[model samples]
Target: MAKAKNDSLFSLIKSLTQTEKRHFRLYVKRSGNTQDVKFIKLFDAMDGMKNYDDKEILKKVPSIKKIQLSNQKAHLYRQILSSLRQYHISQNIDIQLRENLDHAKVLYNKGFYKQALKMLDKTKVLARDTKHFTIALEVMEFEKQIESQYITRSIENRAEILTNEVLDTTDIIKSSHQLSNLTLNLYSLFLKKGYAKNPQEFEEVNTYFQSHLPKVNFDNLTFYEQLYYYQAHVWFNKIVQNFPNVYKHSLAWVKLFQSNPEMIIKQPVHYIKGYRNLLGSLFQLQYYSKFCEVLAEVEALSQDKKVIQNLNTEVLVFQFLYISKINKHFMEGSFDEGVEIIPELTAKLEKYQYKIDPERVLMMYYKIASLYFGSGNYRKAIFYLNQIIFYQDVKLREDIHCFARILNLIAHFEDGQDYHLEYQIKSTFQFIGKMNQQQAVQKEIINFLRITGKITPDQLRDEFIKLYNRLQPLSEDIYERRPFFYLDILSYLESKIKSIPVKLVVQEKFDGLK
Candidate 1:
């Protein structure tokens, strides 16, 4: 039996919204062969299935032979995609531009050169305005073809004009492509090795960014060129731990979309990304007011069904909304409030598990663990941290994995799972070694946790104070603050020393900030 999880057609049908399913059904019915088509029967069977089982499908639709099932599923998949294409082509800009280009081609082949040229002209402008440079280039090629074969004296200078336009557009596209490539490389570096934790690391990233950056005339750049220009700088600044520059470029990124609000609808993925970076920068800088304002805008946009119609956009909406909610609590020391949303958030995470990036989902787990820890539910915190520690996907995020192990140790220790504390300590050290993340802060925390069981209960408070004093400076150290960012070990120790709750310590720190 074929499992639903392994069936592409089954997954696709399951992914569709009710409206889309209705559209596909109506489309099949309009074809006039719905009752006799095996593919349609297969579609209905799969759609109704809670799980994909080939044996069950064969039982439900006896006409489909077992040997022919795969082919039928493939045909159904293609039909669904075709229906979806017809449904969404009008709503998508790139599809509209491609259709125009295709129409122009058909007209040209029919010897309607004048009509073809007219269509190309309109599409070229739309494509250029939307930064659909590849499509614009194709349109230009079509225009050139029409001009060569059906030229009139009125357009005698058209060739030269078109030549210059092509060259200019090509230059802009090349520049944008290069900037985008550089930005992606910088982002990959960030995922592999977070923000530079030391002066040497910062210098290395800065040098690489400076060397790879393309030279361009910034003033004459197109919307995409300008966006990529700012995006490249934003990632570079983020890597070098220059939060001020990160904010500046991130704000510029958001402003570009704001100035061209139409682009937000036309290129929503980029728009969401810009907002994400802007929100992240605000959170890092603790700009609570502006963060809240931008977060509200994000929430408002997410509520717009039209804006989030795309499955990818819907996933991003869930990500940004939930992450921002967690950050809001983190900023205000409101872990209890943060805890209230976990049930809903967990359900969404499971619902969108395949669509959302694993790294982001794991980050939520870390945040949830942090919330539990702050609220003094150490066992629950440990429960969440265990999810991160045992997660088999190593490519997600090394820093998260590294810190998760450290946090797991602290949670276990605080929850009085001291019998296995030594074992966990050794296991974490080995994991850190395997991950190649042997930072001073990680070592310090691991060492303290390792020795806690050996300390007499009478000296535990003194030992906590000693560990607290030693880690306090490291927690503040710019080079060693990365781990501290993930788990507030210092605050936890302060709570232990003062005989108060960790949440209170966090609240005091937040109050002191004001």
Candidate 2:
């Protein structure tokens, strides 16, 4: 009896075919025994039932048939029963459909796009026949996205190939639109990597772009225009350094700027850049007169206070002052005639003094002294000269030497007795001597005294030659370049000391010439 029951159980398990499986699922669900068979559990059981062949169990018991009959109460149960009965007739069909769909998804994820498409082609045909429009549309979108990725990858590969080859600017010009996007990307890449491998190409990239850029429509450019404009300016600046001759057309730049202030101002700072270059070119050409003419026009156009303030803060103000000062110094003018302009200038300096850098402020002091000295306003010259000497660093020995001469002249000038020339002379010499013992600035005091009329030219010349001869080698070691300034004074003193009419005093360590 035990052996017979075991055989019966095994047979029943084998005979659970698709139809019997569906009947079993329905019976399990509604049989108040909602415990053993959930939907997934029953579905999995039906999946295995595709391979089951249990003829003996079907012949042995009517229990499975009884369960199937119990499931005929509702329309859904009837439909389920009928579908399962049909599934039993063709056991392997659902398994093949599921395997095919699973294979399609794996191919899609692995980027085997063609194979995935082939699988999807069959899937879509089946889905359409079954009227699954939503699922079909999803597959269509996935395919479209893949096609877009293919096009993007093709374009990227073409760009990489072009980068490896020689780039002809002429070809780029002809195919500007197609090449424009790729060229812009290449430019950014080259800039990032320091472009050491292709330095020359990188340098000329902007020149090519600038020449071609104007022809390229601004609105049509896909790049951020601001970056393009910055590139143009950077290129032009370098060009100006190498070939500033292009800036000879100051009038053209001025005219362009005048006609379209808004546009020129907005034009990437590159368009108006040639003006500064033009200023430099004018200086080099010694077109001082024309330089003055051009600069006046630029200054007039840039008269807005905000613009002037920006220029000053950028350190370009020093450049402006330099050009103006050079032009004023060389352009024809009476020494005293320029003195009347000082008060107006003093007000300007006061206005901008807080904004000025220390180096420029010292330059301003130097300029003021030069103007005063040229006009023979010795007191004012002495005042500004003192300011410069006090403020400047001691390492600037050349300027200090010149300042000493100025002090000597001021000490000798009419109404100049109030200032202490000797004290200043001693102080300057002491400071320089401490730093460099070989320097002989103190030995020149006799010539300064002659300039002040405290000694005759003959006395000064004798003293100076004596001091120079004794200190000449020492001066040479201290001063790397030329030694001795005041050539005119040196010449005159030489003449006086050697004159037949004058009897020079030569001091000796004796009561009389031994």
- Top candidate when judged by lDDT against the true structure: 1
Question: Model 1: per-residue lDDT, tens digit, 91-182?
Answer: 78899998888898898899888888888899999998778998898889878777877765437678899999999889888888999999
User: What are the TM-scores, per candidate, against the unseen true structure?
Assistant: 0.95, 0.36
Clash counts for the predictions, in order: 1, 1
TM-score of 2: 0.36
Model 2 C-alpha lDDT per residue in residues 67-136, reported as the tens digit of each score: 5422322333344445444444333333334445668779868978677767765765654443333444
383 in model 1: Cα distance from truth in Å?
1.7
Candidate 2 stretches greater than 4 Å from native? 1-154, 158-288, 304-315, 322-331, 395-415, 430-514
Which residues of candidate 1, in runs, are more than 4 Å off?
A: 146-154
lDDT, residue 514, model 2: 25
**Worst ten in a row by lDDT for model 2:** 501-510
